[model samples]
Target: MKDFDLVIRNGTIVTSSDIFSGDIGIKRGEIKELGRNLSERAEDVYDAKGKYIFPGGIDAHTHLDMPFGGTFSSDDFNTGTKAAAIGGTTTIVDFAVQPQGKTLNETIEMWREKADGNACIDYGLHLAITQMNDKTREEIPQVIRDGYSSFKVFMIYEGMMVDDLTFMEVLDIASENNGLISVHAENPFVIDYFTKKLLESGKTAPKYHEISRPAYCEGEATNRAISLAKMTNAPLYVVHCSCEESASEIKKAREEGFPIMGETCPQYLLLSRDNYEEEGFNGAKYVMSPPLRDKKNWNYLWKALNDGVLQTVATDHCPFFMKQKRMGLDDFTKIPNGAPGIELRMALMYSYGVDKGNISIEKFVQLTSTNVAKIFGLYPKKGSIVVGGDADLMIFDPEKKVKISKDILHENVDYTPYEELELKGYPVATFSRGELIAEDGEYIGSENRGEFIKRSGPKII
Candidate 1:
């Protein structure tokens, strides 16, 4: 009998904490051993000379197949998860929105129907609570017990925004029941006031999207959310934080011993408000919630990531075709609010953040993979490469260079926001549970192999 199902030889193993030159042995979809040399037989062997072996990425924020702005996101689970694998992410926790009159159970079933036989990689769901009633209240604990351990509440948006009372109740119940709450930290009133003023003044351009939603909108709501989390003694995760004002608030709250964490995306850290100035209706492609901020906020977010103030980096991967984005041609408000980055997160972090000296390689791993898994309760199983952990791995080529464009990606979208961005490092191969699903940006995986992960409570690391 073979000593292992497969053995990867001669790679530099890297985790959030350490790096060493060794080999990884895999059997039965789990890591069986980690050591230098094994002369024992194996069914397959991969020589990964001069490569870096790191745990597969876990994107904690994504909107695959989700509905927003009157249309469905273009990248459904079938394409989205495969694109994520090509980019080195093996798992994703996507939001399942509860409609105005739907129960949490019904919402989960709807999302399950969308992903059941489509996904090519593992995934989990976070319920986006749109209504709060006595029945919903009673179901919260049961949902947590059933392994749906994180809930989402929107602080903005017209129909999805929860009142302060509902937010407080959700926080209280989530904290009491060991679930965590994530919020879209932007004040709706502020957005409404500025947007109405801009449109009334004949400023209905894509540039006005950023003007209507200023940095302070995010700042004010982030502060309020942190205060609410403190009052309820619960952990709060601020998603897609885009400005220095919000980062400062999160930093101060964390320093004061609050269980507050924030996530920032590459568009916020690399792209800027200037993207909204692309000629004509072309600028609609860059329109997203908490619109990209001034370039000055970039370094501040990078510093926050390095200093532990911002603990995670996620791609709010909600893609839409250019035709869908053009619905706002006459009015910017009709533009869909998202961009595609699920296939670019790893390369961007590796090239810009690590190679550019903004963050260390270990810090890169923590921000992109390890910290995400820990906060979402998949720590040792999904984030690390220790013995007995899932064989989710990425073999990276530190010196390889790639020029990114929509044509080169697997996401089911018409445009790429990071078009023409050059990168010095990229994933050469990706493995999910011992299966080589993607190699060199080409997918080799089967559909519906993904299992819905039943996660435990938030680990708070």
Candidate 2:
């Protein structure tokens, strides 16, 4: 019999802390040992020559088959998770929306049922609060106890936005329950008024989409959300933050020692408002909430990430086909408020951030995997490669080049906003729980391999 279950030999191991050349030995589904040439034999061995082995990516934000506008996103749990695995991600935390008037438990159960047998990697849920009341606020402690420690409260979306009173109440309860609150920071009322005026003036094209939801709307909401978090003494995470104004708001709060965090997506860092001005209805493909800002804001976002104002990078991978995007041809407000991005998030960030000298490789690991795991309470068990940690790893090839095209991606969406963009660096192999799920640009995992990760209480460290 082999002394070890498997051995990954002679690779540069990169973690959030350090980089070293060594071999990782696995037993069952956990990392049994990591060092140079251990005195052990294995049933299988992989020669990882000239590659970087890192912990599998954990995408903190994604939307699978989310219902928006008049149609649902094309990719469900199975296809989306498959795309994630191929891209070197082994875990995802998707939103479980509590529709207006529905109980949080019911919404969670519905989302759980949807992902039961369709996922290909480990998964978790973030509850989206659509309606906040005394009962909903009271349920925070129970939900926290039930292992959903993070909740998303929107500042935009007409039917879903919460008022100041409701927001304060929810924050108070979350604080008491040791939970973190993520805000979709955009002023819905301001956008609503502007949208009506723009449409009334015959500005119905996709270009008008960005014009309706200006940066100031996002800035104002960011400031308000930060104030609410301060008032309640609760930790806050601003999702998909765009523009310098919003980053400044978060920075100011952090400087004051508030527990405020920020996350930005690949779209805001790579794509810009120019994409919304494409000819005809093509611009609709890039239309998402708090739409991409001008080129100048990209530098500010990088600064925020470098300065520790922004803590995580996520995909917000919501999708709609080109045909579905046209649902709002006569009214930009009717278009779905999302874009397809699961497969391209990590590559785009690695190419632009790390390759361009904007961030260090260690920082990349933190923003992409470690911080996410820590915030959601998955820490050493799921985000690191130390002894006794889960053996979820990826073999990264820095020399590999890829050109973006929706036709080749696993997402069911019809078009991708980054279609012609070329990227360097890609993941050649991905493993989840010691099982090889993707290799050589192909996915090999079967459905239902994913298990729900129920969060425990707050971190003791």
Candidate 3:
């Protein structure tokens, strides 16, 4: 008889704090032991001699089977989770949005239906409060009790942007319930103004997407949103912050002790507005909201990542194929606003941020996994690789390389924005609850193996 269900041997274990050579023993899906050596026998054993064992990534922001602008994103729960697994992520918390005049519960039920038997990894949901009423406000506590510790509100979008009063109420309700709020910060009026001007001049190309949504629009809205959080005395998380202007304000707000947090995506850090200038319709692939900022803003974002202004990194993993993005071939406004990135976040960040000496190993773990767990109530359980923790881990090859290519990637999309961008690090093996889901860039996972998680109330680390 085996002492444990599985054993990871001779691996360098890296956690939020320290790194050391050791072995991990797993039993029934949770970590049973961790130390230099163990004489236990197991039915399955992995010799991780040259790899670094870390907690499997938690991609807290993802949109699988999301519908937008008359078309649905390409990846459904099935393909997105598989891509996440191969990219070293073990779990994802996708957004659930209520349609106009609908209840939060109904939307969650819809998303749950999509994820129930299709996802190959654990998942959670964050309510996107698009409209509010007495009933919506009343539903807050139940949502919190149901393990959804976070909520999202949009600052810009026709038929979706909540009023200041609604935004403030969301802040008050979430804070009162120990829940956090994430805002998509962009000035809708500013975007409307520029969009009209650009089109008025016949500037309908994809490049105009960035031209209309400038950094100032995001910065102004960020400042405004933080001020509202202060008024309500609520904790705020600004999602997809893409410019130096926004980071600077967030830094100042944090210095003033306003309980504000900032999040940015790999696209903002790795790509820039220059991508929008790609010839013909090629630039449409990079057309995400808070569209990629200028190269000059890169310094500030990188500094913020290391300087404490930004608290987390997420993919906002929403994708649309070239054909979908081409919906706006004659009108930029019709372009679907996202690109394929669920599979490249880890490797791209490691190759760009770590190998370039921009952030320490511990910081990388925290940004990609730890901080997300702590913020969304999955810490210690999903973020750490320790005894008594879930056996969700990734064995990474620090020297392995992969050039971003759609043909070889698994985002269910036809193109990758970072095509030909080579990364020196990659996941060799990914395990969720001691079950091997991916190995050496190939998915060996079982369908419907995922379960919905119960998250704790909001609290920051």
Candidate 4:
């Protein structure tokens, strides 16, 4: 009789701290054993010679079926999570927004209804706090107790931006309740001034999007957010950090021993502001928040990842179709601000970040998988390959190459921002809780197989 449900043999298993060649034994949806040449019989076995086995990546930032700019994001949970698995990510922590006048529980229940029967892999939620009243403030501790331990606050968006007092109140409440606050750090007023000046000058083009939101806008807001966290003695996480100016502020705060963490997306590291000049509206595909900076900022962010200045790399996977982008044909501000990247983060990081000698294989796992889990309270359970942990993993072929194109991708969008970008390493198979979900660039899993993860409070790593 087979003693295990599955056995992955002859694979080089990797983690954030070490790399070794071994076989893994899994049963009942959890890792059962780890050893060399495991002699136990199994119902099924996969030979992974010459391939690398990595713990399934955990993307900490994603907006699935989200409403923005008069329409919802193109990829809903079903398509979004499938694309994430095909890209080697087995779990995702998506944002759940609280509409005005809605309570915290209502917000979570609404998002749950959207993802309950559609998500393909395990998922969690981080509440985006839009309204902070005496009632909402009272709900923070209970919400944290209910397994959602992180909340988001925007500094720039019109309906989402919180004033300084509200932001401070959030920091204070989260600190006392042991939850973490992630911020979208960009100064709205500064952006408004620049945008007004550019529009009056008749510079209405996609390129003007980058011009209206400069690096300083992000830098100033980053510093201000950090200062507020310091005053409240709260831990803060700055999301989608784009340029050296913002990274510099984060590094300085960390040096001063403040509880601060920073994350940068793959778009910021691989693309540049010049994308805004992509021969007219073609640039609209690259229009995202904290707009891509000068090419010079790339190396600094890369170096920050290797030097421990930045802790995680996430996709900020929010995609919109070209039809939605064309809404701003005459006015740059009307363009929906997001691009598809959930399916490209892993390969892009491996090709440019690791293959180019910018980071080691271990550090790659740390930035893309391990640190994210640790920061967001899913470590060991979702981020590590260990006995008793969930059997979420990926088989990566290091030598296989693929040229990215929208036709070959699975995202429910009409175009891919990473069109024609070749990548050297890619995931060939992905497993979630002992079930094969994706293999060879195709999704083969059953619908509604993913479960909602109950996460604990954040762990300081």
Candidate 5:
């Protein structure tokens, strides 16, 4: 019998906390060894002579075919996970939203069916709690025990927003179950007031979307979420935080020993308000909630990432075509509140982050994979390349260069927020559980092969 099924040799292995050159041996879809080459028979061997081997990315946030704003997101699990594989992301934790009056379990099952036979890689789910009724509260602990340990609550949306009282209740209940609560932190009233004012003044341009949801809208809500966490002793995640005000609030909370964390995205790190002012309808393509802020905010966010103030980076990967985005040509609110980037995240973070010296290679792995796994309860099983760990790995060509354009990506969306952005460094090959799925931006994997990751309760690092 062969000692190992496959061996990836001679690459710089970068993990969350260490970087070294070695070889990784795989067998039975798990990493079986990590050391200098040994004389062992194998079914296959890959020579990664001048590359880097890291844990495949884990995009903890993405929306695949999620119905919103009168239309479903363009990329379903089929296309989204394919895109993720091609981009070297081996796992995704998409959020499953609950419709009002629906049971929490029902929402999870509905999303499970959607992704069951479609996902090309492994996946987990974060239950988006839209209702806070007695039954929903009563079911929280059981749901956590059932492996859906992380849940999201929005602070700003019609028919979705949970009031402060409800937010507190969620925090308290989630705490009791050791569940983590991620908040979409934004003050709805402030946004509504400004949105109405902008409409009245005929300032209905896409730029008004940013103006209406200013940094303070997120900052105020971030602080409020932190307060609830403190009072309930619950871990809080401020999702899609885009500005200095919100980052500052989260930073203060963490410094004060509160279990508060912040998550930002490539859009906030790279793009800014200027995109909303792009000529004509181009602006609508970047119209995600808590819209991009001034470029200055990007500076603060990068600093936060490097300084450990922010713990995770994810793409709220929802896509809408230009035709779909055009639905709001006369009114910004009608446009779907998202942009596509599921397949572009790892490349951008590696090229733009590690190559530019904005962050170290090990830190990049943490921001993209390991930290996410630890927080959401998939640590050694999903994030690291170690003995007895799943063989979710990526072989990256450090010298390879890639240019971002929707034409080259696998996402079903028509346009990309990072279109025309060129970057150095790309993943040449990706493996999910020892299975070679994608290489050189093309997928060779079968759909519906992904299994749902039933996670444990919060393990906040």
Candidate 6:
């Protein structure tokens, strides 16, 4: 019999703290050992001669089968998780929305039903709060104790935005329970007024999407959310931060030693407002909230990530087909809000953020995998390649070049904004829990291997 289940030999192991040449041995589903050279028999062996072995990525922000303006996003848990695995991400923490008038518990149960048996990798959820009441607040502590420790409250979105009192109530509940609260920080009132005015003036093109949700709206809400977090002494994470204005707000809050974290999506780093001007209604494909801003904002976002003001890079991977994007052809308000990106997040971030020298390789590990696990309460076990941890690994080739095309992507969405964009790096192999699920752009794993992961409490780093 083999001494181990699997062994990856002669590889450059990269972790958040160190990079060394070693062989990693796996037994069952956990990493069994790592050393310079070990004479151990194994059922299987991969000679990763010159490749880099890193922990499989963790995408902390994604919207699989999310309901949005008039329709639902295209990818369900099965398709979304498959794409994530092919992209070298072994885990994802998607959102569970508390629909209006419903209790948080009800929403969580509903979300669990949607994700059960459809995932190919491990998954967790962050509760998105749209309703805050005595019952909801009372349930918060119990939910935290039950392994759902993070909740997201929005400052924008009509009918979804919470009032100041409710926001404060949520903050208090989270603070008391040691739960992290994430915010979609944009002033909905401002956006509503601006969007109404823009519609009145006959500005309904995709470009108007950006015009309606200005950067100032994001900055204003970011600043307010930071203030609320400071007052309640709760940790806050701003999701999908887009502009320099909002980045500055996070930087200021962090400078004061506040427990504030921020994350920016891949669209904000690679796409720009110009993408909204694509000929015809094609631009509607990029119409996510906190719309992609001017190219100059990229520098500020990178700086935030490098300086640690922004701690994670996630794909708000809400995908919709091109035909669905046309739902708002005459009126931009009716268009669904999201874009497909989970499969491209790590590659694009690595190519643009690390390969370009904006951040070091270690930082890439932190932003893409480590910090996400740390924030969502699944660290050391899922995010790193340490002994006794889940054997999730990826073999990456930094020099390989490939061009992104929507036709070849696995997202159920019919189009990709990054189509034809040249990228210099790609993952050659991906493993989740000691099983090889992807190799050289081909999927090779059993379906429904994923399990629903519950947040057990605040991450024990």
* Alpha-carbon RMSD to native, per candidate: 0.9, 1.5, 1.0, 0.9, 1.0, 1.3
User: Candidate 1, clashing residue pairs?
Assistant: none
Clashing pairs in 4: none
Cα lDDT tens digits, model 2, 1-461, are: 76678888888999988999999998888999998785357788887889889898999899997877657888899989999998889999999888878889888889998898899999989888888767786788898888898888888776677888888878888878888788999888788888899989999998888999899999999999999989888888899998897989999998888888889988999889999878888889988988988999999999899888998899999998888888898988888889888887777878888888998888888888888888888888888888999999989888888888877687778888889888888888998988999997789976679999887544421
- Where is model 3 poorest over a 10-residue stretch in terms of lDDT? 35-44
Regions more than 4 Å wrong, model 3: none
Error of 2 at 291 (Å): 0.2
TM-score of 6: 0.98
User: Once model 4 is optimally superposed onto the true structure by TM-score, how far is the C-alpha of residue 440 displaced, in angstroms?
Assistant: 0.3
lDDT of 5 by residue, 204-258 (tens): 7788889999899889988888988898888898888899989999899888988
Candidate 2, superposed: residue stretches over 4 Å from native: 457-461
Rate residue 223 of model 1 by lDDT: 95
Q: Can you write out model 4's per-residue Cα lDDT over 1-461, one digit (the tens) per residue? A: 67788999999999988999999998988999999766457788988899999999889999999988788899999999999999999999999988888999999999999899999999999999988899899999999999999999999877778999999999999879999999999999998999999999998899899999999999999999999999999999999999999999989999999889999999998889888888968989988998989999999999989888889999999999999999989888998888888988888889888888889999999988989999999988889899999999989999998998988789899988788888899999999998989999999988878899988888765
Candidate 3 Cα deviation (angstroms), residue 328: 0.2
TM-score of 4: 0.99
Give per-residue lDDT, candidate 1, residue 7: 90
Candidate 5 clashing pairs? Answer: 117-448
Each prediction's TM-score against the native? Answer: 0.99, 0.97, 0.99, 0.99, 0.98, 0.98
Q: Compose the digit string of candidate 1's lDDT tens values, residues 174-246.
A: 8899999999989899999998999999998888999998999899999999999999999999999898999
What does candidate 3's lDDT look like per residue over 256-288, in tens digits?
A: 988898888898888999998989899899888
- Local distance difference test scores for all models: 0.91, 0.86, 0.89, 0.91, 0.90, 0.88
Better of 1 and 2 by lDDT: 1
Which residue pairs does candidate 6 place in steric collision? 147-455
